[model samples]
Target: MAKLVDLTKKPYNLNADQIKWVEDTIAGMTDEEKVGQLFVNLFFPGSDEYSGNEFTNQEIVEKFHIGGARYKGQDSVQVQGLLNELQSASKIPLLVAANCDSGGDGATNDGTYIASGAQAEASGDTSVAYNAGYVSGREATALGVNTNFDPCVDILMNWRNTIVNTRAYGTNADSVIKYTNAYLEGLTQSEIIQCIKHWPGDGTEERDQHLVLGVNELSVDEWEDSFGRVYRNHIENGVEMIMAGHIALPEYQKALNPSLKDEDIMPATLAPELIQDLLKTKLDFNGMVITDAAHMLGMTSAMRREDYVPLSIAAGCDMFLFFNDIEEDTMFMMNGYKNGVITEERMTDALRRILGLKAKLNLHLKQAEGTLLKDKSELEVIGCEEHLEMGADAANKGITL
Candidate 1:
């Protein structure tokens, strides 16, 4: 049997009862439930139809028992209503997440559109970053979302990097670190889980991962001083989650193992050296590692879905980001487990981290209390005057002379 992770550890910090609950819950989960925990499906707000996929969010939960979901931004009332239904449908509490990098409006329709990353970088003030996280966390959580994917830490080194240019703070490591730390502080105060994204760094390449396979071409020492510096600081500061991107850091991979051919170098999401050795072992991140969306060509082009789907989980990513097709992907995952692509040990480790995150969020307690969704009164904070004013001030300060 795989060794059980100590739930009372730093990131999780679950008490004895909470630990027991997490263990007991894991022990009781069926095989389907276990596999489902490895996926975080994407859903749209307006309709049951999305991207030609007809399955409703409820169907995903009922059929696959998915552990988490990411939803598009909508008005507070509509967002909350749909989330409540998904929460009620699942046996386990779902980790509802939103892309709050721009601000709370990234999650909720009426939320404050605080400074963009470029704006925040231009302002050159860490407090702007802090409020971006604080205000985003406040509005997002008030609408029942538990995870915030913000403070895109990619260094804007290549000016041609359009995808992450406006989403990043700046080109300096010290500046990125300072702003990221401040953002973490602000998000923590609002009591929401923070997940830093595009791991092993981005912006070194001008290509978008969505359209092509992106690579971070820095040498080992160069990366260590730059992107490595940023990640090391965040990991040390107790960031609870990371989103592994499809970008590759081949130099580091080769340094870890000289045998790895150039063709064998995969994106961080599908690379054991990057995810397991570099991120988990070297960096010592105990938090959950999720893939950046699964459907992106950055990932899909690497290999067939059947191979990469399970390979993502096997590579140490605890959760796959989105589904190509619910049934087909689930079948691929199950087949991987059955065919031995995803070993039992790897599966257990992924489950432990996934459940550990949920437990850390106190989902178990809220599930029992039937209080997953806050009342509509909390919606008042969505675009409150105070937040709007702060956002406007931040925006003006970010304008370059």
Candidate 2:
């Protein structure tokens, strides 16, 4: 049996009432609702081009009972209005997220484009990175985003790596840690939860996971000193979430089980040794673990969707990212649960952590107070002059001769 998590402990820190809300909410859910809680679907408010299958936001919440939705719109007003609609439609408060890595512009066209990881590092000031995160939080919250996927912590050891070269803070662990801490500190001040990314680390391989599988070929001791050190610091610093990339960490997998063959190795999203053992147990990360994105070739090519869909959650990921086909993927998760592929213990564990995240955000409190979203007046900061000037200042400082 999996050991039960102490909701009252660190990370979650749910009070008695909040704990009750988490437990009672899960207890009241149907099997379908429970299954739905495992996914974070994509949304493009402005166009049908990215709408997954033309399912409206209300339909998604009603039909899927999804735990979260990531906004992919490019307009500020559209994104905010759509997000408010999504939150109002759901029975449970949705964990709305935006890719705020560069800045608020990651979510909307009118948002601030503060600085890229490379630019922030080049500025020679951690405060530049801090402002980037703070401005991202301010604009994102103004647009109804409660979660941010930013501060790509993957150490850029391989310069040829396409995915994280410019996105990463620096080439070494110490530099990456310094800027990531500053960024998260600024984001934390805004009360929007932070999700650091690409676990087991990326940027060690030249290939992009979106196009093909990428491996972090570091030896156990080498990994422990570099990428492992980076992750340890973030986990200890109280990051609310971590995004498990499709990249493989073969060395650590082999160290844990000597007899395991090369073919047995899988991405962090489907490997129990990595997710359950290494991340959850060895690293002692009590917060939620969400997959990078399910549609990437690195994840899809490894196996058929039917097999890997359930294996992801069973492997210990708390939430799956994006839907390839809404109806089919929803059924796949439902069938996986019904067939006992995802055991009751595992299901409950995932649910508790998912709800624990919402409870930590005090979504329940905000919902009851009818203040889950800020007023339209708050949208003034989306691309205001002040934030634009901050972005310009950071850019000028980051300029190199």
Candidate 3:
């Protein structure tokens, strides 16, 4: 069995006020509200006007009390307006997140479009990578996106890894670490909570996790030297969160549990040994561990629909990303907790970590101050002359050919 980390100790070391806020906030939450905190629902900025979905964003916010939201493909102004509306409607402040990997352009149409990792590496200028993160972080923060799912630190060891080629820093560990660290530095400077993704790495597999379960076939020692090294370095540097991929580490699984059948070995996202033991204990990662989209075939295909919430919670995941039906999923989690499949202790632990992250981001203070993205000047920075010039400069310098 994977040893669990002490959940009481504050990883981010919240001060007394923040600690009190987290405790009080969690205490005030009902079971449904607590379960909702574990989910990061998909938020389409312009979807409110479409009339296709029965529940509007505000309705969902009121219904679920969702902790955060993941956004994609909206203009800067639209994103800002929608986020402000959602945040205002929520009982607790929402942690707005986006896949702002390439820059804010990755999530929004009007934001600065920067070069990919391949292009940045081709420039032979690591500064371009840093600038890419900075521009992305800056624009994301200005637009009320507090969390960014970016700086994909996966080492592309497989030549046939199509999904992560441009997304990842490089094929080599050293280059990936250097560029990733530099990029994280820039991103963190803007105070946007950055999440280093596809933990235990992702590029070794020829298959994409989006379609099927991806496996990293490296031995324990090989992983220690490559993916492990990059993740360890970042964890030590105080990364806010780590997104565990659907990829399986067979060697680690077999070594940890020799009695288990081959069919019983699961992906890192649903394996306690991988998450609670390997990641939490061995890696000494004190930050939150979120799963990749639960709606993906990589996750859903491996387990029954009802097992998703309970199994993932047992696997020590702090948050679940992108369920097919937010309302149904939220109800499933609530029912799981009530039925004792997901223990209250586990739920509280997850809530503490989630709330701790929110406290670290000072969401409580921001909520009280009513200062979240209220500044017109900060909003003006989105796709401004200076940012656009920076993006163009990065593109010019980052031409691969």
Candidate 4:
């Protein structure tokens, strides 16, 4: 067993064996290296072009020791290049991930528009959901995406809820659980870590957390009755990570102690009671716990809103999925440590969780899988049937309701 490494306090201490591994094997990471573990950013495949503006490229990841990436396209080659660059560039090897919600198609166009597994279940023949998930995992694994932000476990409680519409299987918790497990089986069996998202259930909320803070109408017990099953079940089954969103459940919101209640129980990304207390303590999730995106207004950011990095840290988030707010989180957290708002202990705790998860991916001190470049012809399989068949299998075999 590897020696326990602690990051809760500064002047951190890992046993000598652990220290040698992190320092000697991990390119001698400093506090900066520890900080980089807190991020997972968006990717534009070929380079870094977002909204027609190119703010970052392969170089930024290399220079900053970025943790991982949330890829956004089907250009497998470009995705490969970016992943390879990000992983190879980091002072410590990186964890390359993406939001392959409906498979990589959600990430890129070269992918098939296989109906989300959730939609497949509603239409019957769970095979559709299964195949879609399976195919997507295969496609990504072949292309080099190590982790997938998928199998949206948000229980579909409100049919009128515009956001989750087709994203969820149905309002039935059992249905969601079955299909979710199948989706995970296909993806994890492929060796890609799957991140079931929008914790505490975003299905009951009518608003989209991306645009504004969303709220769940169910009380804590009601939520546990309806949707919390998905979250707990998945964690129990050993999912590697979970992404909390900007939605608030009144029960959770009302329970918050001072300093936090002022934020409206806000996004799960910024709430400690939700992230730490609910997720870790209550739900017993021991894997990686990441935020949706710091730049999202529904959530908090270091630039526009007050800096939320410290609060997110103190509350118990292991990583920040960044679409455009890395520098600020890095700079602000650095300041938090120096200024004393976020103690060294909190910093180390966050870093340990981050490092521990990435390490689970075998991404630090040890290189994980998906390093080989695909043959040019493998590109043809990007949106092909064998892959589609896999998704169909997932949908058919996985969905029971």
TM-score of each: 0.97, 0.97, 0.95, 0.84
**Model 1: colliding residue pairs:** none
lDDT of 1 by residue, 165-217 (tens): 88888887987888878777877877678899799889898988999888999
As a TM-score, model 1 comes out at 0.97
Candidate 2 error regions (>4 Å): 1-4, 48-54
- lDDT string, candidate 2, 173-232, tens digits: 999999989888878778788899998899888988898877899999999999988999
* Residue 91 accuracy (lDDT) in model 3: 83
Question: Can you give the lDDT of residue 142 in candidate 3?
Answer: 84
Clashing residue pairs found in predicted model 3: none
* Rank order (by lDDT, best first): 2, 1, 3, 4
Task: Locate the minimum summed-lDDT window of 10 residues in model 4.
Answer: 1-10
- All candidates in order of TM-score, best leading: 2, 1, 3, 4
Clashes of each: 0, 0, 0, 32
Query: Model 2 scores what on Cα lDDT?
Result: 0.88
On residues 1-401, what C-alpha lDDT tens digit does candidate 4 reach at each position?
11223432222223454444544544455767666667776766665665454456665676556777777654667776666666665656666676666775764567755667456676566556665677667777666677788878887777777777778876788888887777777666576777888876777757877677878888767878877777778877877778887777667667644444444556677766777777777776666678877766677522244367766665577777773555656787667667776667666656665665545545543444544334456567677867666556555555455
Per-residue lDDT of model 3, residues 286-347, tens digit only: 77889998877778888887887667876889898876766567777877888887777778
**Model 1 lDDT at residue 392:** 88
